[model samples]
Target: MSAPYVLVLYYSRHGATAEMARQIARGVEQAGLEARLRTVPAVSAECETVAPAIPEHGAIYATLDDLKHCSGLALGSPTRFGNMAAPLKYFLDGTSGLWLTGELVGKPAGVFTSTSSLHGGQETTLLSMLLPLLHHGMLLLGLPYSQNALLETRGGGTPYGPSHHAGADGKRALDEHEISLCRALGQRLAETAKRLENNRG
Candidate 1:
């Protein structure tokens, strides 16, 4: 059997969400699991703009098999009008095969997002990411008030998941609170998945 791992899948436009994914992956590894970071190609209106088989930088493209076999999941995306970016949505929309076969059932999952403004629908975007996971029968995980950062964050921490305020130009780095919450969410998801795996054993 393959070794268990957590998949940190995200679509980052200007790098903030990607940085969050890295922090979350750090937490996953801190919990003693492999963190597999993957990303999707951007979708274009033209429908003919195809991305290369491999990205020039950052994490490699994600395959359905990665999602299917992951012991846990940390999903992230940038906010688009209070929703997840279209590329991430498009990726999830193509996962009906996994849904149909129940490949992701019982896996622990969490969501994260980066928004251009403090009130730029961070929570809503996180919630939007959860819908597909729910349909896959995956167990949802979130940051608890016990994390402290969630309670004190002035930028982008939520009970739904971790978030970031990327500023109007999308260049703002994640603040300390946001990073802590991202790591917390990842650790929580990894620990939960480990416990669940043990139960299954």
Candidate 2:
């Protein structure tokens, strides 16, 4: 059997969300699991428009197989009108096959988001991401109050998941608290997955 891995899947527009994904991946590796970073191509309104097979930079596009084989998942996206970005949703909408087969059942999952403003729907975006994962029967993981960053964060941190406030220009770097929360969520998912796998064994 292949080694267990956590899929850190995301859609990044201004790059803040992508940085969060990297921090989450770092935490996943800290907990001794592989982190497979993947991103979705942008969606265009025009039906004929298609993204290139290979992205110009950042993570490669995600495949259904990536979602299928992941031992755990950390989903991230920038907030778009209090919701996850269309690209991430579009990619997830294509996952009906996994849902039908229950391929993701019992796996641990978490969500994160970045927003242009502090009140730019960070929590709502995270919640939006979780809905589809719930339908897949995955065990949802959130940051517990025990994490100091959740309480101390001035930029973005939530019980729903990690969050970042990128400022109106979308250039503000993630604060220490936000980064800590992101790493915390990743570690939590990895540890929970390990426990679940051991139980099955």
Candidate 3:
């Protein structure tokens, strides 16, 4: 079997969500697991075609197979009117095969998002990402109150998952609390995956 890996998949137009993915990946690795960070191609307003396979920089493209095979998932996206971005949604829409085969059933999953404003629908975007995972029967995981950062974060952490605020200019860095929460979420997910793998064996 493949070594256990947590897939940190995200779509970031302005790089805010991408940073969250990196933090989440750091947390995943901290918990003694591999973090496979991936991103989807952007869908242009001009047509239905996918963006180029190789991005200019950063992570490589994600395939449906990656999502299907992951031991745990950390999904992040930029907010689009209180929901996940179109590209992420579009990519997930093609996962009906995995859903039908129950390939993801009982696997742990979590969601994250980056918003341009304080009230930019962070929770809503997180929920939106969870909907498809729910259909695939993945066990949803969230950062619980045990992580003090959730209570202390003035910018981004949430019970749904780890999040960040990019500010209107789209350049706000990840604060300490946000980083803690992301790591907390990652550790939580890796622990859950290990426990589940053990239980099934």
The best candidate in terms of lDDT: 2
Reference-based lDDT, residue 84, model 2:
96
Q: Against the true structure, candidate 3 has what lDDT?
A: 0.90
Cα TM-score of candidate 1? 0.98
lDDT against the true structure, per candidate, is 0.93, 0.94, 0.90
- Local error of candidate 1 at residue 187 (angstroms): 0.4
Candidate 1 per-residue lDDT, tens place, 39-122, comes to 999888789336787899999999999999999999999999999998888899999999999999999999999999999999
Whichever of 1 and 3 has more TM-score, that candidate is 1
Clash totals, every prediction: 0, 0, 0
Q: RMSD (Cα, Å) of candidate 3?
A: 1.0
- Superposed by TM-score, candidate 1 places the C-alpha of residue 159 at a distance from the truth, in angstroms, of 0.4
Q: Which of the two, 1 or 3, has more lDDT?
A: 1
Worst 10 residues of 1 by lDDT: 44-53
Give the runs in model 3 whose Cα sits over 4 Å from its true position.
none
User: Candidate 2 — worst ten consecutive residues by lDDT sum?
Assistant: 44-53
Between the candidate structures 2 and 3, which one is better when assessed by TM-score? Answer: 2
Instruction: Show model 2 residue runs off by greater than 4 Å.
Output: none
lDDT of 3 by residue, 84-166 (tens): 99999888999888988999999999999989899989999999999998998999999889889899899998999988988
